[model samples]
Target: MIAFPDEAAGCPLTGIVASYTPRLAALAAEPGFVAAVDQHAAEIRERLFAQGPELMPRPLRRAELTDYALGFLDALAEVGWDQPVGYDYAVDRLTAICWLVHQNGLLDA
Candidate 1:
């Protein structure tokens, strides 16, 4: 069994999806980022959550979570989703999502 000290053991993908939603919302509010990001990411992101989030064996610290969220957002900025990016971007997104879950925090911070 997993034991966290006075903390929630949340799912990482959910946090990323939540965070992505807000960023997407804000970006959509932008002049052209919306169509660009959507045209770029819609289908690729569909595969992002295909099997749900893969959790970490150990609980994450707040800083770790923040780093993860940044990693994901960075991947979005760098990859935009449809093109071929190095696997580093994929690793960042996946790790960041799992970290977000462990921290029980959204990508907002």
Candidate 2:
């Protein structure tokens, strides 16, 4: 099994979410920020769940999340994406994914 950072401590995923806290806080003054995050979370959830004729939410194996996260980071690197000093959609999406992973206890798997 791939080892993930300890969630209780300072996981990189958690840190990523925390790093954007200020931006999110500032953006909270306007509408749509929370909605955008919720939408991102839904997207991440779809990626993490099995897709088929079933209607229920069947979570894929934990390894899938690891793969998804690594692939995302890889894609960012391939595109020369850098974390901007200001609000960035990529960072927000990643933060949402991290939050989902943490909330779903995928890090422990």
Candidate 3:
């Protein structure tokens, strides 16, 4: 498991991953899982960057991840989502986002 800094532990995005890390790790052992997660991360990264320059004029930094995670949660709430008993695309994407953030050293930035 990636050990984020103490400061990063309080981040909502970190919390999101904490909930799913066990499953994500198991999935990582499967063939092609890493690639799929990477793809999802790429998609989400693009979406974040696509936020108008006025709102995100610079590349996304670690500090911005919390806001992004909150926005994602808000959107899920808006759509009336319920946590699934099994894996789903949202979970996969979120796990992927967490991995992306960790792998890119964003949490430490």
Clashes of each: 0, 0, 0
Off by over 4 Å in 1: 1-11, 42-109
Tens digit of per-residue lDDT, candidate 3, span 9-39: 4467666656656657766476566666778
lDDT of 3 at 26: 60
Error of 3 at 2 (Å): 23
Q: lDDT of each structure? A: 0.42, 0.62, 0.66
lDDT of 2 by residue, 1-109 (tens): 1123343342345444455445555445755666777788888778677677877887645566656766776677788887776546777787676666656776564
TM-score (all chains, Cα) for each model:
0.28, 0.66, 0.65
Q: After superposition, how far is residue 66 of candidate 3 from its true place, in Å?
A: 2.3
| TM value for model 2 | 0.66
The TM-score obtained by model 1 is 0.28
Return model 3's CA RMSD, one decimal: 6.1
Winner of 1 and 2 under lDDT: 2
Off by over 4 Å in 2: 1-31
Candidates ranked, most accurate by TM-score first: 2, 3, 1
